[model samples]
Target: MKALSTALTLAMLAGLAGCVGQSGSAASAWYDGRDAIPPRGDRIYICHAFGCALKTPVDFAGRDIAALRRILAEGRGSPAAERRAIAKAVQWQERRVGKIVGSDKDVGGLDMQNAGVPGQMDCIDEASNTTSLLLVAEARGLLRHHRVESPVARGFFLDGRYPHATAVVRETASGTAFAVDSWPEANGVEPHIKPLAAWFNDYPS
Candidate 1:
């Protein structure tokens, strides 16, 4: 719910930017009649790390949950299978938001490359509601498919602080750990494990 709230706030701000809106729906507003969301199986949710003043990832035009979940379920037993699942999840999320371009080999599109722009113009709205739900669903689905026994926390990086809902995965086995954020440097890219005090000393409770 905290993540959704953060996402909704971002979406409302983007809507105020005067570039996104449609039928009073944030999704319709951002797409502007373009039918370009990628396959559902590949979409991965991203959030803003610095603040909520970034563009949101457009939801690809025709993604269904079942399809998205199925695609995210790929990569059962390969080296970096978790990585593959992460990549595919991001692609699915990016495409759904209509941010991806052809042959990019990455999700979150130009935003992925820049790492600053949010996933969509209406990301906040979508995230708090549809997008966030989809992302969380995918994340859970991944755990189920991989038989991963660790808990994954989901939350938002707001104003350089991680707030709202978050999952902390504490398992001895090596599992994937990364932040899905608007900062170009962190777009589906995992960073070295540093002490929480190092990056978020002023983190909110």
Candidate 2:
């Protein structure tokens, strides 16, 4: 199944490349125009503008969910712990997805090649994937202190900075929203988890 998915991804990428070119705007639009594909039971699909990787999708059954739960366990009752768990879970997903898509060495931040590379992900990809992961965690009741929210975006005309987007989680007690931004970090690294206010003021580092 994994082999078949890989073949399909390669084929779709070949076709999409011609339509989207290497422009980041085109790539971003291509991603935004697509509907969010939800997880089917224990399986979740990871999307790239070039094509969706893991045709069979990643299965979150049994050990996978257990691993996630173990990560979440580290933060059990506190928002800070939940944030750490969120970061760890996201990094785990990044590593798994990167391996499946063969983009394990992808660098962080704005890279021109990301617009064209099959496995390299842009901010849209990161935000979408993170939201999906958070949603999955929520469904499994692994999150106690934080609840996943819709992906939030800022910048471009709104902030005079480059367009950026991230997944958000709201603390149940304080109702404070924190941005879980994975695009500015290298693959498999912990993402920037900060208050939405601070995240808005942040420049890429």
Using Cα atoms with residue i matched to residue i, what is each candidate's TM-score against the true structure? 0.34, 0.78
Tens-place lDDT digits, model 2, residues 96-136: 77877655877788785657576777776677678778777
Where is the poorest 10-residue window by lDDT in model 2? 18-27
Q: Would you give me the overall lDDT of model 1? A: 0.34
Candidate that would win on lDDT: 2
Candidate 2's C-alpha runs over 4 A off are: 1-33, 49-56, 157-159
**Which window of ten consecutive residues has the lowest lDDT sum in model 1?**
163-172
- lDDT (Cα atoms) of all candidates against the true structure: 0.34, 0.70
Best TM-score goes to which candidate? 2
- What is the Å distance of residue 50 in model 1 from its true position? 7.3
